[model samples]
Target chain A: MDILESIKVALEGIWVNKLRSALTMLGIIIGVAAVIAVVTIGQGGRAAILSSLESMGTNLFVVYPSSRNATTPITRQDLITLEDVEAIKNIVPTVKAVAPTSYLSIMTQVGRQKEKTTIICTGQDYKSIRNLELVEGRYFTSEENNSRRRVAVINEELAKTYFSGESALGKQVYLMNTPFIVIGVVKNDPSNALGFGGDPPKEATIPFHTGETLFRNLRIQIEGQTYSKEEVQETIDQIVKLLHKRHRNEGKYRGYSLDQEVATANKILGIIALIIGSIAGISLLVGGIGVMNIMLVSVTERTREIGIRMALGARRRDILVQFLIEAVVICLVGGTIGTILGTGGALAVALIAKWPPLITPGTIFIAFFFSASIGIFFGIYPANKAAKLDPIEALRYE
Target chain B: MIKISNLTKVYRTGAISVTALKGINLEVAKGSMVAIMGPSGSGKSTMMNILGCLDRATSGSYIIDGVDVSTLQEKELAKIRNHKIGFVFQTFNLLPRLTALKNVELPMIYAGIPSKERRERALKALDKVGLADRIHHRPNELSGGQRQRVAIARALVNNPAIILADEPTGNLDTRSGEEIMDIFQQLNQEEGVTIIIVTHEREIADHTRRIVHFRDGVIIKDEEVLTPISARTTLAALPPAGEV
Candidate 1:
């Protein structure tokens, strides 16, 4: 029989039992929709995390001091020094910029408002090194750091809290009861690298020289040895060499790179996304099984019809094509509707939750083709059964 | 022409076998009207199935028009069914979802006739069966007699070498049954189309020029009717068209 005629017959069969056909297609629809939505949501999440990590400076490295002694603390000098930063930049050609930093939490007063916030003290080029942005004012100049001027930069949150209804630039804020002029209001950084929780830090910044002069005496112990200003580089070198030289400490420092950390986090997120997507794909498998079940029922119901066609000279291939087309039509229709619903669902969630949900063309193609294949795969047994039916037996069927 | 010798059909149901046809021998001339009469389970229906290429015999040497049907493949058998034989069932078997015209056009579609020609030939067939005005009427809308007439038109549409009917009037009342038999007789006598019908009624058998009696899957009697009644006269004796 002609293919068009077979299609017509299949369509007529579907039309004759509209409710059954629709119910059969529902499984495929939900399956495709779930697959599409889950994959899109996963993709959106990956993009969100990657962006957050990237905003922390893709090439920046952070090192924390470690000590075996319970009484020892990782002082700013013990962890890093100006000389080590210079040496790393010069000796390691790949190292771009390094700025040592120290922070302390102190209560500060601005006008009548008082808040406790962490204040960071770093070198002149700290802003450039950490990729900080200034929204309202400018960073402190090198001359200000050399002169030990009491100048500070406030983060956007701190600026909003202390300088509400007024510009924070050139304003005076009290840090540990010491008056300091705000040279700049820093832009809110996208990454929350230093925050204890997932939130960005609320803080202030000051020149490292000014911090050193105000704080007076400082000491850092490394491996039972006391390290002062001149010995800071020696302490850092001993720590690095000791950690790398000992076989017992090899695991602690093995492949310990910032890029590796970022890559590991990305890999973890990728695995989570895949797991969620596969769980959703189970619905598609169930839908395909539903198609197969409904097709079997349809063949049983249409036995007499099959017999009539066979009696009218329909070949086995014709019977096969007719039933197979019916199944494919159901799945194709379901896939199309599922894609639309899935995209709409993703968009609605993104809008409500305010998270970026990406729906790519590749996802659409995968969903469509996957559902079509499901139809064909599930349709085989029923089609074969119909094709193999004996015309005499079918005709005599009640 | 048709020939069958030592044709046997055994149907297996699990471990048991039922012989539907046993060593049947028969011959039919090119353009003759013949009817086979038998009781239920006498295997006349099985003989009809084998003759129409709807079933295969377990052992046989059956030839139609020159081709050995027993040696034909399933596809070749389907071709024979498509272009060499037309079937009229007692229940009409008109597709309920299709119109009378489409029901008649079904065979032509299987024959790969294009839509234009299929439509033309279907309409002409319906016209021959005196259902031109009811071409678009679905089976449920037509009376039993009209439905059976539509089946006749479908049988004629493919211009097959032989027309096979299995108890064509078994489901109809006497009047409608007589009307159907008259149409069959007209096709055989006027168009010179070879016809073979299986029926249990002697009156129906009398309408044809020859009768073959089947008993226990075997032919017991074969006789010729010297005085062949004119079917057109009987058809004319009925009420005019559209009066049922």
Candidate 2:
């Protein structure tokens, strides 16, 4: 018989046993649904992270001393210092901004409020590079930093606790027995700073030279930016070369860009998506087995029908094709329904989470093909059984 | 035309063996109407199945037209059945899900006839069986006589050379049975198609030109009737249908 005839018969068979066919398809529905939802949602999360990293600035890069593998342990003298930062700024023409970090950990007091916090000391360029806006006074000048003036900038946590709704600018706060005047307050943004970047720090910022002069022992963190994101690599190479020259060719520094971090983050997320997709695929295997089970039962139940068709001059292959087509129709229908449900669920979740769910056509195709293969692979045994039956015996079957 | 020589069939079930048809030789001429009469387990139905190519013989040479069908493969045998043989069962073996027209079109479909020609031929066959108005009726919606007529239409659609019917009137009332017999007689006479009927009723067998009687896997008698009963005449004398 023709393929169209077999398909018609198969469809009719499914329609006759609609409830049973639907029940048999449940496993496939769940399997395809899970794969669709997980992959789309995972893609959404990856996209969200990439955009956030993009907003933070793709031009951003970092360098740290390659301390662990060095032939000799790095000392304070071997670490990045203020002289190295100044030399890099002067030598690397591609460099747009440079900030040398030096910190003094101490307890600070403003009126009756006292808190133990580190005082971050850096240059005026730190404000522009950090993309921070001042809510109160201005940052310290280059001359004030050179003169080692005892001035500071504070975050909102300090302002809320110490000032108690009063203006904190121009107030005196003592750190490590030294009195410092508050100059600027950075605006607090809690929404965008989520996960891993936990609660904002309750700290103050002082001039680099002022903190360096006050504390004999200070840990330094050097941050810099390039003219553009594309110039990051050139600027980094120049920084390492300048640092090597200043530190007598120790070559103990390392640099990274935020773009690289984004790539690594996406790679990790992709692996996680693959792992979850595989876990969901296990249910598909079980679902295929269910199809096989139902197909076998259907074959046994339709023995007499098989006999009739055979007597009507149907070949073994015709009977086989009919049964196989029936199984495939069930799975394909189930897969279609599952795809709709999964896409709807992903969109619903994305709406709630305020992120776009990314579903590619490739993902849908893979899922549909997988469901079809599941049907064919599992349907073969039962179809073969039906095809091999003796027509005389089948006819005699009550 | 059919020729059978030493035709035998043995069925095996694990350690048990049952011989359904003993050694037999028979010849049937083209365009002849014959009836096989026998009681239960008399091998008449077995012979009919072998004639219909539904089962293979253990040892024999059965030739149809010019081909040696006993040596043919399962696929070749199915093709032969599709092209040349038609069957009408006592229960009127019409597919329950199909309309009468679709049922008639079934064998042609298996024969690979195009859908348009199949439809045209099926309609013609149904009209020949006087069921043109009932083409859309399903088997369950048909009376026993009408169901049998649909089966006959199905059998005739492929324009098969031989029609094999097993107890064709076993499930019908007297008038319906007589009506069906008349239709078979009309088909054999007008179409010149060879007809083989398997039945236990001597009254039904008497209508055919030849009667072959079987007993316990063997034919006990094979004889020709000098004057065959004309069922159409008997049907004409009976009261109109649907009467108690």
The model with the greatest DockQ is 1
Regions of candidate 1 where Cα sits further than 4 Å from its true position = A48-57, A66-78, A81-83, A86-95, A102-121, A140-152, A157-183, A192-262, A344-360, B228-232, B235-244
- Kindly report, for each predicted structure in the order presented, the TM-score of its chain A compared with the true chain A: 0.73, 0.82
State candidate 1's DockQ.
0.66
Give a tens-digit lDDT track for model 1, residues B1-244: 8999999999899999999888999999988999999999999988999999998899988999888999899988888998889989998888888899988988888899999999999999999888999999999999999999999999899998899998999998767888888888878878999999999988888889999999888889999977766655766786766555
Alpha-carbon local distance difference test for all models: 0.80, 0.84
* TM-score of each model, in listed order: 0.84, 0.83
Q: What does candidate 1's lDDT look like per residue over A1-398, in tens digits? A: 77888788788878888998899888988988888887887677667767666665555444445554324444443444455445544554334444557777778897678888887777666687556788888999889987989999989989888877689988899877789999898876665632323556678989877877766542211111111223433444444654334323322321123344568777987898889889889998999999999999889988988888888888888889989989988998899998998888887766774558798899999988998898899998899999999999888877
DockQ of each: 0.66, 0.52
Model 2 lDDT tens row, A306-381? 8877888888898999999998988898888888888888888778867668888988998899889988999999
Model 1: chain B TM-score vs. truth? 0.94
Best by lDDT: 2
Q: What is the interface RMSD of each candidate, in Å?
A: 1.1, 1.2
